[model samples]
Structure formats: C-alpha cells, structure tokens
Target chain A: MIENMTEIAISQLLSETQKMKYEDYRFVTASCVSLGDDGCDVIYHFDKDLEMKHLKLRVGKGEELPSVSKIYFCALLVENEMKELFGINITDIAVDYGGHMLLSDEELESPMAKQQITIVEKKGAK
Target chain B: MSKTVIPFGPQHPVLPEPLHLKLVMQDEIIVDAIPAIGYVHRGLEKLTETKEFTQNTFVVERVCGICSCMHALAYCQGIESLMNIEIPDRAKYLRVLWAELHRIHSHLLWLGLLADAFGFESLFMQVWRNREKVMDIMEETAGSRVIISVNTVGGTRRDISKEMLTKISVIVDEIKEDLKQVEAAFFNDYTVKHRLVGVGVLTKEDAYALGTAGPMARASGIKQDLRMTGYSAYGELDFEPIIEQDGDSYARTVVRLKEVYQSINLIKQCIAKMPEGEIVVPVKGNPNGEVVSRVEQPRGEVLYYLRANGSKTLDRLRIRTPTFANIPALLHMLPGSQLADVPVLILTIDPCISCTER
Candidate 1:
C-alpha cells in the first residue's frame, strides 16, 4: 500500500495520514545506517498498522523530511531500539534520552557510532 | 474494595518462559492485564545479518525449542524462494515427516503442560510419557533431542534411511495407539471438561479482529490454515485441519488432541508417499532478494520476511511470530473470565513467549 518498503512510500503514507484527523503518532525511535553508506534505515512502527506501514525506510542522509509518527501511537519503542542500534537521532521528536533494553547504561554511546579514525606516529617512513 | 496489583511472572511457577504479567484484581477477579516481554530477547534479527545463510540454521532453530524444526524450515524456505531453488522430492517429504512429528510432540507437550497447570499430575505424566516416543524418534533420526538442526538452505541435513523409515513407521503406529488412549482419557474426564469448557470464549469476529491464527482461530470456526497454501509437501499429503466451533478452552484442547492424531496420520502419509531424490542441494552464491514465507507453527501462522543483499549476511530479517500477533487477542479474552481460569485460558492460545520475544 505504501510503496512496499521505501522512503518515498513513507512520505506518501505520512502525507496521506496527515490528511486524516488522527494526530498522536510520535517518533519513538529513529536509528539505522544503510549497509553501503548510500542510504539510511528508518523504522516507523505505528500502533495501528493502518496508520502507517511498518517499514525500513531507506534514504540519503541530510535530506529534508516531514516527521510522520505524529499521527500514530506508541512508536517510542521502535525509535528507542533504532536509536540504540543505529545511533541516529531525530531532532524534531522528543526523546527519552537514555539507553534502551538492548544496551547497558555505561555503554550509552552506540557501538556503531561512526567516529573518525586518526593515527599519530612520532617517526615513520613515508 | 481496593484492587491490588500482583506481578505474576518473569519467572513464575505457572509460566514456563520468562513473561512478566501485571495483574490488577478486585477480590480474585482480574480487572486488567498487562504483558511485559523482552526478557528472552537475543537480538536474533541482528544475528541474521552477521551469520551466513547456512550458518543461520542453528540460530533460527533455537528461536523456540518446541517449534525448532518449523522455524529452521521457514528460514530456509525464505532463502530457497529467494534463490528459486527447487528442492528434491525426497527432501520435501522428509521435511513434511519431521514437521508433523514435531507438531504431534509439541501438542502433547502443551497438553501435558496444560494438565499440570490444572493440577492433573497423572494426566500430565501420561501425556509426556507418550511424548517420549516422538522425542526418541527425533533423537534416533536427527541425533538431537530438541533443536534438530535438520534444515539447510536448499534442503535438510538428515535423511531417513530405508531401514530407519520402516522402524519409524512401526513406532508411529504405536504412538497412534497410545494417542487413542489419551483421547479417551481426555474427552471422558469430567474434571478436564469442567475446568476447560466455556472458560475462554473467543467469538469468530474477535479471533479475526485480534489477528489470532493456528488452532485458536481454527477453534473459533475460522477456516485458516497455512497448510492450505501448500508449502512443503502438505499439498501432496492427505489431511484436513482439525476445527472446533465452540471457541472455548475445552474446544481448544479438543482441537489440539485431534490435531495430534492428524499429525500422526500425516506422518504415515509422508512415509507412504515419499519419492526418492537428493536430500540437499549444494547452495552457492550469496542470496540476494526479498521473500516472505508462512508456516503453521504449533501456535499459529508465523510470517518471516527476509531481505538479502548478495552478501554472506542478510540485509534485513523480520519475523512476525504467532504468539506476538495473538497476544492482543488473548488480552481481550482475559478480562471477563474468572481468576482461576486465567492459566487455562492463557494456555488455550499456547503462549510461546520465547517465540514472541525473539
């Protein structure tokens, strides 16, 4: 119905649901990087499967997007799991700002966080 | 009267798996029920992305020990469909044979557990004693007691030898006879009927609306069996779904009991109709595609959606287990029933929280 597992389908679904009167869908989780670094994996699980199709929406980073979970219920868990697993943050949605069930408190920074690697050496042959 | 909230289990005597239930009761009548899972979460979906297609069999089989073979078969079938691999005729029949064997053992295990839940210790022992036959057969054939890692990407790992087949058929006949005794003991027992009948009444609409599947939905008069779609060798076998119209706890017990008989018959049918061919095909190349597979697990319809991206690992794997889908429906059926009926009613759907959480 919503373009069979893609980002455009997510946008189309969000737009269609926005036209309806329901307005409680909140982003519970938003975390995931695509395999080849070409796209992202966004899991938007609506309490009512009708409100939104459960999808792994793939898109390039830094793309302008409309927040969709605003029209669904209980998406916090999906967002939380994603955030914990992928380390992607949703600026627009209010987050609980803690580690999820999968990760411990001490290991808050996700393992998958893409930190730049810098090597320093005193004396080396070029 | 103030209602008291009692935490039944993440580990309780009644529940086998680690499922925490918050029960709010007013004078022994449960008013509200909240199910909290995630205790047994193993990040299985995440594991699929790291493990190779062939290596994922053992991992998938451990999803639920009782439905191990079915889960492995489902995962393999998903990959098989994606690769468009045509399984050998013998492998199909062997798969069907093991599937039916697992089904019978699973139902018997549930029946035994249900009996114990109701304080019928002897019935529990009797049913489990019968269960050992299938377990013995599994151990003898597959070389493992619970997680029979028989399934592979293209076909199965174990093959039933002609000599083993004859012995299996003979033992199956013995199990069939033992089942008739159980059938009489269960159906004729007044206490069993008094405890189960009309306790948990799920109407047909409630069953469908709540997305209940497997025996619970079948018991409620909804003719939905994944086998009808003819996955595996079910199309070749001669069997019909065991259905009951009462939609009560007792009806569910009856349905499972009859299904045990059907599974035995179905196993025999597989033996009679098995055609000779290779047990497994050598799978090469990375599986790269999306495929959806449906299998009739002991509980209900289990849906697996697998996406592979031409690598040693999968791109994404989504599992919609039967108990996960049936939980909402079970919650709806709980409020109106008496407190004592809770365990029996809960068992009616055969709650497999491990399968659900995984």
Candidate 2:
C-alpha cells in the first residue's frame, strides 16, 4: 500500500509542488489512471533522501490542470507523456509535445484512457 | 554566424536503439537538443490489462531487455504488496541473486558500449568478452541468458542449488579478476580520460532538480539510491552506494565501474547467506487497492504502480523506467558540448529506448 499519499485539489497542486521544490524534494515521474467518463487521476511522485511523497490530482475528462514542470523542470517529459497517452490537458507544459510525445499521428489517440472499455460495458448494462 | 540543425538518429551507427534528436547548433557547438522517440513504442503496459495478473510478469519482463528480471521482480512485488502477501525469506535472497547478476552484465555491457563510443573498438570487444562470463553464470542458473522470468507474484519461480552457489562464487571471483584488467584500460588510458573527464558535465543541482537516478545521480554528489530502502535482500547485504563528486562523464564511468565490483560482492553475500526453503508461496486471489513498487535497476530506479479491483485482471499497471527519468538529464547534458562528443553523451545515458517507450 502507498502510504503518505495526500490528496490535494487540482488547483492546489502547483502550489504544493512548489513547496516540495523549496523543501529540496526531487520530482519523480507522475502516473495517470483513467476513471471512466474520460476523468482521470494524476499522481505526482516526489522524493527527498529516498523517502517518497505522492500527490494526487483529479481531472474530469476534458478538464485542464496546471503543470508542475514550472516548479520542477524534470516533470516536462512525464507531463508530456500523460498529455499524449491519457489526453490529460495539462496546460503550460515546459516543452509541450502537443500530444505526440510518445505516440505518432497514425496511432490511436489517448490509447491508455479507459473510456472505450467502460463505455462498452455501460451500454451492455443498459 | 548562421545556426544549423543536424538530425541525430532514428538510425545512427552508434545507437543500439532508435532515438532521434534534433540538434540546434551554431557551428560545431550544440545550442540545444530536442529528442524524438516513439519509433518502437510497443504499448506493453496497455497490453498488461488484458492478461491475468500472474501472467503479466512475463509481459513486464519484456519491458527492457537488460533489466528484464528487475521488471518482473517489480511487478511481482507490486502485486504481492497489494494482496498483502508476505514472501519467504529464501525467495527474497534468490530474487537478489538474479537481480544483481543482471546488474553485473548490464553495467558491463554499457562499459563495452562506452568504449565503442570513443573509437576504442579493441577495448569494447575485450570488455564484452569478459561480460560473457556473467552471461554464462546466468544461463547456467536460470536456463536462459537474458529476461529470465524467475519471479512470481508470491515469490521466485526458481531456486539455485548448493552446487550452483559454489560454482557462482568461483565464477564471480574470476569475473572480478577479469574486471581488474579492464579497469586499467578505462582508468589509465589518457585518451579515454580525455574523452570522458570534463565532457557532458551535469552539475549536482541539475542532476537533483531533473531527478536523475542510479549511476547518473550517484555520479553527481547526490547519495540517493533505492537499495538503501532495502526492498529485497539488500537490507541484509553489506554494501554502500558508490559516490563520485566529479559529476562529469568520467565520474559516471567511475561510478558504474565501482558498482560492478559492488554487484559481485552482493552476489557473493547472497550465496553465503542463501537460505534453504520454498522458492514460491501459494498466492490466492487478485490484487486490490494501489501500491508503488520501486527497485534499483542497473541503469537507475524503476517504479511500478498497480491497481486491481478484486478481479484476476489488473485495473491499471503503470511503469516509470529510469531511462525515461534520465532523458531530461540527457537533454540537459547535450547542449554546450562539441559535436564530436555527441556519441559519448548519448551512450553515457545507456539509453534503453524499449524501456522508455513502454
């Protein structure tokens, strides 16, 4: 189980990350999980002397959230990855790949989002 | 002076994998390097959701050819953690034995590539020739050379016998002796130092701020190593994370070399303390809830996030590889270096494009 995971509102994420940076915490990568209905949870991992802290942010489908790349420059690639894979519209990325960070134009868009499967299952239930 | 843009590899002779970088340059010095990857994006993580949680071990193992066992180990560890399963002591030590062997060969393989990057073909061949000894040990113990799928959700699938342990001790000594001979070439050669010493310097501040891992972070002044957290038998083993203050390409080289010996020592310790018992436990039910499993792979730290909703299939499996974490550092190191040293800088990262894309 992941301990010390403190859930923060999406609006408070940027400030919390800035606080982590000021406290000398190194920014680890972030992971995005689709929560059906195009909504998702973005967990930003940070470390200080090998101790990890996880911050979770929720984005409802086409919603936009602030990027931590401004506070922690290392977050650029991972943020870009979440942008492309899960279609989380994290605005103001340090270097935006514009949804092609890890995928090509020919590939399926937001390939990792769980909406398709959820939609199919919901229709079956109905 | 007009600026120039040079494309460096979706296919380059020096690169073992496809990683393209658009070098924004002025004359011979690189002003910026914009990396482009995805030529071989396999979508392995997405594929894992389809397979049963137990079978996903083999799928995750294929994430990186070099750190295959570590990938399986991390996945198994995650599933085990989510299920609240306590693995046996003997199995924990067995996991360490195989994991460190992977480390030995991986660092050795990178050393050979580093030599090849600087036009030292003979040194490259010699180092690889020595590396084959470690590979022989793996093939003997695991019945496979790379990607030995020995880890399971509860514990390990295979165990090493007393005879194999004795053989490993003898072979590890031989590998250490062989490494000493190559060490002279890497450390004493004037040209090797000239290529590495001051080239591709990443300051301690940049390394930490950018979240560099493994040798890259240790090469700088940071003392961050996941082994200190002691996920496997590492807590019982007597070893320390090698530290280098230089934070240059040379320091990175030195750290990896020293770690080669560290891995050998770890293998010997695991053999000496090899507990005799069951290799695997009966793990019942599916993983539920969320957990993050972290392991120190040869290149750096690898993170696995797993969530399951009381079913055989996992709901989510996210992998964050070290090479992915290190790319920002790779971009940070690229600019301001001479064009000729580009190969060394890229090779210094020991880029596993397969792992990054996954």
Off by over 4 Å in 1: A1-8, A11-126
lDDT per residue for candidate 1 within A1-119, as digits (tens), equals 22233344545746654543244321212335444444355544322221233445664433333444344322333444444444444333233333343454444444433431111
Count of clashing residue pairs in every prediction: 9, 0
Give Cα-based local distance difference scores for all models. Answer: 0.72, 0.88
- Give the alpha carbon lDDT tens digit for every residue of B244-340 in model 1: 8989988888899989888878888898899987899988888887656668888877767677888988777767677876766677787766778
Error of 2 at A34 (Å): 0.6
lDDT of residue B160 for candidate 1 = 90
Instruction: Give Cα distance to truth, residue B215, candidate 1, Å.
Output: 1.1
TM-score of each: 0.82, 0.97
Docking quality category of candidate 1 according to DockQ thresholds:
incorrect
What are the candidates' C-alpha RMSDs?
Answer: 7.5, 3.8
Query: Residue B265's C-alpha lDDT in candidate 2?
Result: 93
**Highest lDDT model number:** 2
How displaced is residue B313 in candidate 2, in Å?
0.9
